[model samples]
Target: MGSNSHPAALYQLRIVTRILALVILLLVLVGFLLPTEYRVERSVSINAPLDVVSENMLSGQNLSQWMHVQGGRVESFDGVLQNDDSIRLLYDESDEIGELTLLEHTGNIIRFDVRPKLSTGLVHNRITLEDHASVTEVKWTIEGDLSVGLLSPYLAFFANDIAGQNFEVSLLNLKQQIESQN
Candidate 1:
């Protein structure tokens, strides 16, 4: 009876492992079929003027106040690479962890290439400012491609929720800071 029970348990274990392997393979295949391109947008209305909001976006000063970072990774701007239209943040003073460059600035629309190097691909962010009756509406639209990788599409699939929530928190912080100043 003991011998028979041992063989049956081993057989069940093999069957369970085989089923787990098939499930993992299916998940990998599905990830490959998912889209690699992702876009995330978030907006907030600040009770400040258009110029005030635009200045805050363009200032490139005290970025740690409004820029969100999870996991306690702190990066400071490189003074040499910083200009009115561009800001580069680095680690250990030379290793670039993030960069934001003004791609274009039209009448009411401003575009910036925001690459934080936390992951693969270049992230493009567009900021649109509109003057409301008493408040200014600010919109941020970000887009990027995760490129070709087994897990990249899976990351892209969850990018909206992952990055969008971070952006939402950042926008809220910015709104509070801007509103308090006025």
Candidate 2:
């Protein structure tokens, strides 16, 4: 009777602590097994010529007209929207923006490599225009790797829907801008 209560209480506390440790270990194992990268692609057909679409797409000055970018400013730019041109952009005065480099430029395809200032990952943005009779088929793709390790898979899971909506909206705006002018 002198020590019966103390032994029982100690045993109960050990059981609770072991259960919590096991739960945490399972969660960590799941996180490590999840994927960490994603690619988002969205496309739309525009009732405009390829040249018209290409010009508007390549011009940095027209970014605000069709894209919902917040506090975006072109810090520096070189060349004339052609291959090898590099543009430094700052958004919301945050160090999260990236540098856009034109990796490929052609009559029907344009590829850009984006290097973020605060992240170790790179983003590949590609725009392709195909002539379909009178309508131009525009395909926009953005692929990137998430560098946040265990938490990246959770982010990638929703990246497509969120980013896809933005892409669709921007494409609709671009289509309207080009068609209205023609």
Candidate 3:
């Protein structure tokens, strides 16, 4: 007679399958709840010194020149440095109208926090400068988190490549500006 080995064997299999499914469900749930942080960085060496390039880019006036609003702009002046020593900017790039705060500036490093029109979160800009005998090395980094809806984390997997490319372009522009001066 053909017979199953035992009911206990079938019960164990069912338990294992259920446990595996539950683990997968938990992983998916966790993924959806967590927001994704994205970072893009690019670096180039310029013919000038680090301090010189840092001065131009970190200053409010120079920041405005290189940092374009996604769309366009409003008439402006050199940004006023506040009591906290942070530079403030008011401009419209496309639909985004907001301020970019220059947070910190050392000899060769500058930090920025930006408030954009569409979303809520900090966009961090960091510039690092290295002094070389011939040319100065400049590293620019943009790191931020995009708050997600239920489906955003899933889509982020696809969006990261494009986001990285955009970061490259931003760094390229900064590099061009610094190099052009020489």
Q: Where does model 1 exceed 4 Å of error?
A: 62-64, 71-85, 91-96
The sequence of per-residue lDDT tens digits that candidate 2 reaches over residues 21-126 is: 9998987787777777789999999998788788777676565467544356445333257788777757776767767788998999989877755365677889
- The estimated TM-scores of all candidates read 0.84, 0.77, 0.64
The CA lDDT at 172 in model 3 is: 67
Q: Write the per-residue lDDT of candidate 1 for residues 1-182, one digit (tens) a residue.
A: 78999989999999999999999999999987888999998999999988777777544443556767553223444332223355554545444466666777765788778667545457888879999976999898999998756888988999999999988988898899899888
Query: Which ranges in model 2 have alpha carbons more than 4 Å from their true place?
Result: 1-24, 70-79, 93-96
For model 2 the local lDDT of residue 114 reads: 70
Global lDDT scores for all candidate models: 0.75, 0.78, 0.66
Residue-level lDDT for 67 in candidate 1: 65
Preferred candidate (TM-score higher): 2 or 3: 2
Top candidate, metric TM-score: 1
Error of 2 at 146 (Å): 1.3
Q: Which candidate do you rate higher for lDDT, 1 or 3?
A: 1
Candidate 3 lDDT over 142-177, as tens digits, reads 777666565556555544575566556555666688
Candidate 1 residue-wise lDDT at 21: 100
